[model samples]
Target: MTDSTSISLPADQRRREFIGGAKATFPLIVGAIPFGIIFGTLAEPSGLSAVGALAMSIIVFAGSSQFIVLGLLAAGAALPVIIATTFVVNLRHILYAANLVPKVRHLPQRWRILMAFGLTDETFAAVSSRYLQQEDIREAHWFYLGSFCAMYGNWVLCTAIGVALGEIFPDMTQWGLDFAMSVTFIGMVMPYLKNKPMWAAVIVAGAMAIATAALPHKLGLIIAALSGVAVGLSLQMLLTQTNTHSPAPDKEPQ
Candidate 1:
């Protein structure tokens, strides 16, 4: 059931491909709502204008970057500093785009760039997981759009509420809601503990995170994520090689 995503599609497939991509992305969009709500509620007191907050959700949709920008603004940082910090926090998108080039290469330049803007950890998870199933081009674009659109809408609406309620809302710290990010990470990681190699990756990454937790400006997160990616990829490659070289298991005698 592999398709052109695995390289080769029928001429008659038409725009059906787009539909698949859109459909696959929808659930992600739905799931993004709570995160967006938290961001809005937390950032409300940071002096984000409705238009400005809306624009942020529209343009710099990355959650981490948005949070950094809000944090900077909360600290009374300069505009240039906030913008630059946001850009730095989102630089990981460059790597995401590099790895994803092959998947969206066939799309128009405008669409490809727009699609790249939609890249996020959750979107990456969905796309990569789909590729594992069959690499069907049908799913990527549609699913991505569906998810992106939902998340985008959620952010905009939440930000609007936060901005509208700016003066009256209680302090965010009062809610102890800042741990949403930590909870989100745990949610993403716990499900991946399926086997030995995955466990190895998690352990290595967790150790690295603790070791580097003292680093400044959220650098520990980057270090830990990269360590996990590298170790996990290496282990997977090694296991693949070993399996390929080993003889097949023998059947029991009747």
Candidate 2:
């Protein structure tokens, strides 16, 4: 009885963690539904077939890059321009990967690759929050897998729905549905602004984004992201040095 119980416990724990991760992502999934549908609605008009749009959602699976591709196609951009533009837009993923590497380094390469394919803004937010709370959870990767599957399934289903509805509505993209994603992003970001470095980074990024809004191919976003990262790193290093050099408080009387 003891041996059987021991053998079953880990599987049970993994299942629970997976379910918990999926549940945690419900709100973000809600926010992304309309955005996915909007992309679906825009796909045909942007010269992509329904199959192509769905394939992109399945293969590329990056919401921002998919949207940019559609826009570039609509603008009649060259194939290389579309590829380069999407590549630039997704450079932010490098930062995400860097932050996660330490935490996931022990996983097998196959697991890491699968997780990387599923890493997105929503899954990253959900997984990172959990990892922050409990860094050594043995089942954390299952949680990440759950979150990824939930978001992926939701996005694909929503896109299909939009593709079907496009024939009926034909103007669903203009329904102002994409705003939900902006609100969702704000919600995702607001929780991390608990320190000076974070606050400075966000402010600088926001300001740079606004000031450079006129840049072509959405290069302003990249500029804003880099500016914020630089400012944040500088402030963080300065604070670390200050702490290291500061005098220790005198011990109370021995």
| Top candidate, metric lDDT | 2
| lDDT accuracy of residue 253 in candidate 2 | 100
lDDT by residue (131-216, candidate 1, tens digit) is: 65665665456656655565566667866665555446655446655566566556656766887778888888799989998875
Residue 96 of model 1 has an lDDT of 70
Cα-based lDDT at residue 123, candidate 1: 67
Q: What value of lDDT does candidate 1 attain over all alpha carbons?
A: 0.68
Lowest lDDT block of 10, candidate 2: 130-139
lDDT digits (tens) for residues 29-48 of candidate 2 = 99999999999999999999
Best by TM-score: 2
The deviation in Å at residue 15 for candidate 2 is 0.8
CA lDDT of every candidate: 0.68, 0.92
